[model samples]
Target chain A: MEALVASAIGLLTAVGIYMMLRLRTFPVILGLTFLSYGVNLFLFTSGRLTVNAAPIIGRTEPYADPLPQALVLTAIVISFGMTAVLMIMAIGGHLEAGHDKVNMSDTDDDTPEVQS
Target chain B: MLTAAWLVDVAASAVTGDAVTVKITHWHGLEAAALWMSLAAIGGGLMALGAYPRLRALWDATPRPEAKAIFDGIIEPLAAACRRLTDGVHNASFSRAVTVAVLAIAGAGVWAFSGGTHLAGDRALLPVTPTVLALWAVMVIAALALPFYHRDRVVALVLTGVVGLLIAPLFALFSAPDLALTQISVEVVTILLMLLALNFLPKATPVESAPGRRFGDVAVAGIAGAGIGWLAYAMMTRQPAFDPISHFHLAQSKPGAGGTNAVNTIIVDFRGYDTFGEIIVLGIAALVIFALSETLLRSPTVTRRLGAIAPVREDGDRHPMMLVVATRFLLPMAMMVGVYIYLRGHNLPGGGFVAGLVFAIAYLMQYMASGYVWSHARQRYDHHALIGWGVLVSVLAGVGAWAFGLPFLTSGFEYVNLWPLEEFELATAAIFDLGVFLCVLGAVLLALASLSRLGLRTGEDVNTRAFDINPDAAQAEEVR
Candidate 1:
């Protein structure tokens, strides 16, 4: 099961990367969303799989790893910030350049490609 | 397993000692187990769906923007008015450097004077507190009065370094060596990055503003830093009552979950969920960086040449062949040490956190020595992919445990005969460690990469800022 979930995450990441390398902005964003999902899933798994147990010992039979859950709550919150920042950047770029092009050299010189 | 103390007492009716009863009878059986399993799956699935990544994105980016906005509005008027008062500092680089130098000196002075800190235990230094207050007062006064008098950039970096370097002592005094090492490394990277950033900004303009206002500003800043610092110092020294977590750690160190390594036990068993969540945060940070890089992060044709940064100091070849060669020599040794630290983390102070940082620093050194061209050429994995892979591996570890009719992140298993070396105990724990390592590595790498790339963009944000700063002036400049 761990292998399955991990493999899924890998597949998502691979897809995300492929999209990330593409020239369009929206697919890149979609790819990022996929990647973040993969990441969160991965971290949640790190506590190692357990069943029928919450982290609160007496709340159930076997206690689950509460720390990972708590950490995940915060992660969810932080990811929202990241998403917003990304969206804002995306919108900002569209506004500036009038096109949602990935690796646009007009504003951000990220591609590092020599300008024509 | 189902019997309580009283029930067991009645059942046996023989022994009468304070034998520890686990109260196993208040038990949740397989049905309850199924419920929790389903719930975790749901939650994990939602995150995987990226249904609400924006929730955290808001929190992390703005840090409670409403409160900040309120504070800023109130402060802005005063700050604007206060700006008229200039600390008579001429050389901006010198002054900034001096500020950093003063802080570094303070760190050194604290160590030199205190001679390795003892747990003060309610011992308050009121007189020296006043001196600290006075120094802070002086800091403000100097900031205000000598606005025109600038010092070296190195001094400013050191001063900034001093502000946070005290954490190293506190970390050491508390016996958290792993944290101490990470903290110090973080500080080094931060200051270096800050210096690198300063390269792109226009040098600080000479202080030619008002004298009375300068005095007022200095006096205010001094009082503020002093008061804040002293208050924090006092609070730390006071030894606050009601430490629930420490008590919890002590109580749980050797019970129910059954792990002797207190930190590991605490993090994985007691609070594994929290660690899980933090790694998720790391994963998110990586995703966000990746996302951000693709769009609003382009640079100009000339700026492409800027990624090959001039080494730390531009004045001379301070990073000589020997140092470069030495870093090359040490790479393998550092990696080995990182592995050692990572492997022994469950039993010792060294763990994924420190080990990850060690490896990262080693990589950074390589980047510094041979430059990004050579270093990046060897990249086998897309940083984005690495981030995702790291997170997935951690989760998959937990999922495996779930499949076994146990709990997530549960540790301490006996070695079963799997070709005679099937230690689920060690393997499961190691997987978690690797997850942490990847998150840390990805996070620091992305942040620094972003910062470095900032220098490469000469006209970055300048287009936006110039347009905003003065539309008329920008339009005039745009014509040229």
Candidate 2:
């Protein structure tokens, strides 16, 4: 089970990194999503893998680590905020620049500089 | 000898405790005189040897690496390599930078892993059920398919949603009901936000990268994935290096925080400061989005571009009557559920964060069922004010602790018996949770509302009524 989860985290990370490297804003955002998943999962697993051990007292003998869980919970929400902000910036950039390319090549002088 | 005699006379005068002078007559033939003379001769001979022109010339003519040259030889190439690396990684191309960063991180991970001693942990692995395996397979396949279908933006989003949905169940299976709940609700809001932004974005991503570049990216991504996966697996299989501090939280949860849910207690009580900072960050993020969107709308270029794009929903019934009616009915029930979740959060899996998301989703439903114009017209509260007040309330809750001579955000709880109700635990954390609830609710709504403002620029017809076709109007028309 640990192997399965670890493999899943890795795969998600791989997918995220690949997507993030794409030359468009949208794919980068998607990549960030995948990356966040991998990261959140990684952090959660830092408490070690446990089953049927919710952190609520008196329900289970040994409870799962609440510390990591709390941290991951905030991370998930914060990542959402980050994604929203990134998406909006992407929209604004595409609007002003008339293109959504993530890179600006110095050799390609035809494209206008993005307004400050 | 004369100088030695003078020294002896001074010493004898001091020993006699009077001004009497004594002469040293037997200074010569002492063993110390011979030893001092031989030491002076050895020093003088070494000085003479160094002064020899032939030896000085030989030393100067011998070839050796200069200290400066040796230092430069070791440092110059290293400095140049660092320069080259930074140039490659920061060449203004996002993809290239990301690729380099991923590979570098993976390389570092491998280096660290190889440097450490490893032992297979004695901990036993859990047995995987078929249901879990199936879910995992689906999640993996969906994630893998994302990049392939990503050019088709909506398909990629659906795949992302699938992966996110699968994660919630996995959390549930792993005994993190709070996480599962949070994940599920957050997924809905995220997809909705994306869908709104998608209206302005290009439907398909252009294929621009060269085939070779893409292949290179795949290789780098694979290495990173493998490294992180192996690291996670290694850590999970092994016992923690030291005992976790969760034991302290678990033990003190009921007695110290007066909550059965250690996770909840940690968030609102034990680690309330972190939570406070988190909520403030969330509020700031929402405010930034709102501010950016407002700026974007004001820009003539953006407004013109938005106007030129075709409307997202051209010919559909803008507000489906059934969805509108159903959502209208569900709003109160959803609010009730949010209240219930918020009230029980101290002891249960539900908390302010999830409840706040629930309320946001319910309100979002109203916006979806009706139109933004209709919903905005009826909204009695300002999003900015909600955020401000939420923060103020949380600050007040924290400050309330100071009145009792307790530190900030120190929660105090008691079992209170009220009329027509059995004894129930009332905690200051609940008040703090209320602050969290309001902040989260405000932040989510504010962000989504800000994004939806873009829809207004599409020149879609603004609806004044909740639904386009009113039942009373139809009945009156039939009677006429």
Candidate 3:
């Protein structure tokens, strides 16, 4: 199970990096999503895997590590907000630059910066 | 380090009876696993390089007969499936061949890796279960295949949701119900947000990068995947080099914070500072999204582009009356569930984060079903204010502790007798959780609301409420 999880993390990271390195913004956003998943899972595995362990009090079995779970919970919510931001940014970029391509040329000064 | 030791000693003294078992051992199998990962990555990279010439030739072949045939083969069945799905609600059937292919691929990958991972002298602290192992294998395969299976933005977004579903169950199986609840709810909101964002993006991802560049990306990706896999495997299978702080949290939770749920206690009490920072980040992210949406709405370049590619709408399909009526009934029920989850969070699986997402989702459903114009007319509350006020409430919760000569977010509780009931317990943690609940609800809804503005162009009501005609005038108005 541990091997399987590790491989899963690796797979997600690999795919995420590959997609992120793609020229388009959508896949890049996906790649970031994949990376975040890999990171969360990695953090989760830091607390040794346990089956049917107590999460709260008054259970006979030992508890799985709660600290990592708490951290992952925060990470998950934060990532969702960030992903929304990224999606908006992707749409805005496509509209302004006439394409979804990431990594714009600095020499191409046509893109307008958002002023508050 | 000294403080950590002192704290550990304090916790150890507090917990009576059983001695803490500490294992210090060298996990020799990690070296072998690392070797396997490096070898696999390097081999995959080399294979991609070797396959580059043949792949490029196939991609560049005259008339593209093979590629065209493959494309037609996939699209014909897919189009048929889509048409069938549209014809009736009960006619939706997934392709059996695709399902078989997905299973076969995942099975082969898992089987191949499992053989290499059973090296002697290095084993995971917990015994591996077949169920978990199988789920992990399937999840890994799905993650790997996602980029290739869907070039359409909407399909990819849906596929991401599937991937999230796959992970949420794993959290549940690992005995982390709070994490599972949070994961599932966050997944729903993320997918919904993406669906809303999809309206502004091009439908399909065009083939833009050269084959050689693509091969290079695959190579880099393979190395990163392998490296991370090896590190995670090594870390999980071995005893930690340092003392785990989880024991301290487990010991302190009930006695120190009057909460049975250790994870909740950590978030609301022990590590309240981290949660505070996290909520602030969420608020900022939502605010940034709102600002960007406003920028896009105001930009002439974007509006011109939107005019060219935006979907043309037919009558009656814009907002289904049935969905609106259903949402009217469901909204109050969902709000009830959210409140129920928030109130019992300290002792149960549900908490502020999940409850907030629940409430946000409920509100979003109304926007979806009734259209933004109708929904906005009814609600009449600024999402910006919701976010600001939520953060303020939480910050105040933390600062409230300082008034009582306690550290920040030090939750204080007491048991009091109420008429017609047993002793009722009230804790300051509930107030902190309320703050968390509000912030999460506000931030998520604010971000989605901002994105929903882009979708308003398709509504029956054309927005003709522009205050300024000229660019500088609009800019000055925005400043005001």
Better of 1 and 3 by lDDT: 3
Task: Give per-residue lDDT, candidate 2, residue B411.
Answer: 89
Q: For candidate 2, state the interface root-mean-square deviation in angstroms to 1 decimal.
A: 0.8
lDDT of 1 by residue, B44-127 (tens): 988867956776677578744488788999999888666744422322232233334435654664556468544454633223
Among incorrect, acceptable, medium and high, the docking class of model 3 is acceptable
What digit string (tens of lDDT, one per residue) describes model 3 on residues B308-367? 664656553555656667888999999999999898788778889999999999998987
TM-scores of the models, in the given order?
0.49, 0.84, 0.74
lDDT of 2 by residue, A77-116 (tens): 8999899999899988888787888887857654656543
DockQ of each two-chain model: 0.03, 0.75, 0.32
- Could you give candidate 3's per-residue lDDT for residues A27-63 as a string of tens digits? 7888788888888888988886777884698775589
State the C-alpha lDDT per candidate: 0.50, 0.89, 0.79
Q: Of models 1 and 3, which has the larger TM-score?
A: 3
Give the Cα-based TM-score of candidate 3 against the true structure.
Answer: 0.74
lDDT, model 3? 0.79
RMSD of 2: 7.9
